[model samples]
Target: MDNPGSQEVDRIERQESRAQDLHLDRVVATQPEIGPTPPDGGYGWLIVVSASIYHITVPSLLTLYGLVILRAIRDEEHEEEESLKIWDMDLALVPIIMLVIRLLLESWCRAVVKIFNMPRFMALAGLCLTVAGVLLSSYSTDTYSNDHIVNVFAGIFAGTGCALTGQQTDVIITHYFREKLTIAQRLVRMAPSIGNFLAPILIGYLCTVYTGDVIVMIYAAILMQNCLFLASYTRPIYIEKVIRTTYNMLRDAADDDDEVIYSNPNQPTPAPTTQNPQQGTSQDDDNDVVVFNSRKNAREILDPAVQYRERSEPVNNQARFSSDFSAMFAETSSNRFSSNFGSLDVINYTSTSRYQELESIDRDSQNPQPLYRETTVNAPQNNIVFATEPTAGTIRRTATLKKNLITIANMLMDINFYLYALLHLSTTFSILVLGVFFPAYVWLQVPSQTIWWVATTIAMGHGAALCFLMMCLVLPQNINEKTRLCAAFCFVGALGFYGITISGNRSFLILWCMCASFSTAASSILQQPLYNSTLNEFDTTATITTTNAIVAAFVLTWALLKNYEYSTCFLTAAILQAITAVIFFALSFRRRR
Candidate 1:
């Protein structure tokens, strides 16, 4: 038989070894399960092609068709049908209606995605509705008022379909692209220019030849078939199941033991204990478990080797003390500021673990200087890093919905929202004045040159879009600088619009149109990346709020300016744009500093 003291020592040693093994296992379990890499190319190209086609066909077609319908209404046979006063309202309302639906969808897209499982299904449904609407419009042989109602229904279908389909393309591209994302985005953005140029001419000719009803039927047939091709390419990935499985396994393991391994090194160490001779066998056994677990935890975290290594290192005591003082002051100030902001606070949560702190110090010591630096390097982990996945299990849908709603609310509270909204509003006003009123103004100025007006508008818009496409290809993806550059360009466009007010010559008008259009196109393209950058700087991910706010601004400004004369509207647009540019410049400058 073994000696009693030796037996007790052996039992204690075994328990200590078990505790270390448990600690090591916990560390190993904490590592994330890496998922499949995104396919940067391959079948993604087909999706890109489909997206291009959709972009080229849908938006351009609607714009062209709207204008053509307007023209057709104006040119309607008086004997065949009564003139409809609602035609003008129809022309303006079509795009506005489309925009409102798109905005609404955007606001709730994440929830929709969660509920529907995929945007592809929504897109397919939208396609069906679009076809139905077009068919209804085509088949209708009702009075002017009834026909107008049918067209409004058609507008609804086209708007919802185009929004859903168009947005899904963006989602797909973002999922696929990584390194050449800018190039892919540029191609996607540029596709609409082709539609913009060709759609007007094609739709105008088709209306001239076969009537608008025939044109609607043709669009219905073409889109219904094209949507099938689009739907075929859309496939969903099931990484969520894998993530859920991994999470369940981890959680089960943790629940198996009452005393889970504590990874944090900063917590106060528990006192060591020994089994009491007078205590019952079960109590003695429990005491042994607690004593050994506490001993092993302390040894692992507060190892003599690590402590000596840390103590032996050279440090400037003055600098260390200064840094500590500054960090304390900063923390106090941040807490005060956060209290003021309440739920929308910019929380700076540092890991309280000494292990993490030591690791960070080691990294800093190794890299005296890094070639590339992220602004968030010195920021608290919670500020920039989102813990999207939980340690327990898959996040509940209810929780996700609540979280997304909170994010949206916080984003609305951000100052950047107002600034971006202003910028978008100014740009939108200019585009509206150019698109709706410029042609009419040209007709008034030179009724003999109606053909020239159509040609010039198409040429200028397409050319400007092409120029922006080239810029996208050539320019480096510098989001901050691009925002400033785009702002400057917008200012130039504003100046051009202002110049139009004073000028009477056709050459100047054409030149101004070209300049203004080019600037607007460049600004529009750059705004996507610019908005992304601004969101990053704000440390928020609520794109829908930004979009909604911008649209709201547009709606407000449009309401104020819609009844004004074309010249007066343009003049107001210029003034507003000039103010926006100044504010943007100042804000950018301040940010750089």
Candidate 2:
């Protein structure tokens, strides 16, 4: 049955191969790959909640560090020895090389995830490399080559952990609530603020108390280990369902064989064509209807995106089982009757299931190389191809840039953006009042010497957050989602310094903060809508990522070069942000051809 299509035949002989995994038994026992429909007992939500518990603490600390800290660090270290000045004080006293090491680790972590089967080993290797970097850096007495101290331990290890876990966190949660990604992201972004709003004050208090870096390092190390404990809760779910689906697809393909046995008249005997199914079957539960049906059930399960669960009354168990029974019965017949490789076993979705699969290998699948070789672009799945059509549940995927869910997500995210700015603004004004006009001002207690610590913390925060967002966007399916979020994440990094100016009451700082906010607001307003409206995740991902990166980087970089000072730098950024916002607004309103 060489690629048999539209053939009517009997006694199909099919065999398929499957591979090793840590949770093969769970795969065999549970209907794990249960389908687009929400599964019963709904523990996926529980996992989502658990994952968010950890993720909520990550965002803020990464996003806005440099805003309040950088100006003081560089100013103090300006005339210092080269070794002391090697790293930007505002960037967490992290050497320039540590920055490079971090970027490398970010990419490597993504590489590991796309190689899904190798996650355990790859993650371990990442951990080793990171810890080693830290261990080596311990010998550094000065900042010149301090990156060696940063190499394996904190930068490499933490970078890898951030990239891998951040993306995995999204993927796992998305599996449970793909439709709710934007909302979930908005909620998760606040986690950092919750954890870190007090962290600075605590650091200040501790510094006042201990008056040394040693206790600070000890406390920081303890915090990092605690975060690792939270990380342990994250893992892959529903993997077995994926393996089972692949297995059955291949099994149907194997059914294609010679229908006619060659007759040798000179031979002593002729062999019978039909082999007994009962005799050849394995000792495994191949004969069990429930076992075979579970995989089929997930595939056959009507997507809740289109057909949601019945809400009027309690969902009838018998009715669900009945629906399950019918689908399995249909699949059994299809498999049993197949005489060719082309006879698909997909009961309701054979057409889409096959065509969609032509491109649907995981980013990590060993044999299939990525289509966009330079960029790690994952292909579409068979189920998703068919499901891609717009419906109420999926209408957000079809909305225009302004109308899409991503746009809404961006808008919702602004709640935090605005709040963060406002908080910083209040802090800045109070500080300015103290610094410029009156020494008696209470808020003036923030201290000029510790300003470097503030600035460096903000820089480190922005870098860490931006790196996290970038890797997540670039690593998975529908690259557009990643890109959109990446750009959104990068926005803060671009304008971070302005917030500092607003707080300090420097000559230009006020204008800079205002403009920076405007620019970020405008970018989000324009870019997110386009992402929302576009259908092709690839097209959206590619277009938005490139566009946002180019546009956002240019604006931010120009601002940086104009003023590297606390007051003037931020003030300049504010003007640029405002101008960028105006340009974006004008473009957004213009009539398109």
Highest-scoring model, TM-score: 1
lDDT of 2: 0.37
Off by over 4 Å in 1: 1-35, 73-89, 131-152, 216-222, 236-413, 428-441, 450-457, 496-509, 537-543, 549-553, 556-565
lDDT of 1 by residue, 1-593 (tens): 88999999999999998898765323323223533444577777877787777767765544444444444443542222232232233444444555555555654554454456475686677677656755765643222433456656765776667656666667767766666677788777767656666665665555556655677677667667767557754543433445566789989887662443333344344445556678533221211212233323432234444456446545323232132222333432222112223333246444333223433553667654532223234645666343344544355766878887887777778767666667666665565556545554444344454433554554555565566556666677765465467668778878878877776577777667666666665666676777776666443336655666567556545644545554776687788778878877777766531
Choose the strongest candidate by lDDT. Answer: 1
lDDT of 2 by residue, 177-202 (tens): 54455444544543443333344444
Error of 2 at 76 (Å): 7.3
**TM-score of candidate 1 versus the correct structure, residues matched by position:** 0.60
Off by over 4 Å in 2: 1-35, 38-42, 45-111, 117-160, 210-216, 219-223, 226-238, 248-530, 534-563, 591-593
Residue 243 displacement (Å), model 2: 1.5
Q: TM-score, each model? A: 0.60, 0.44
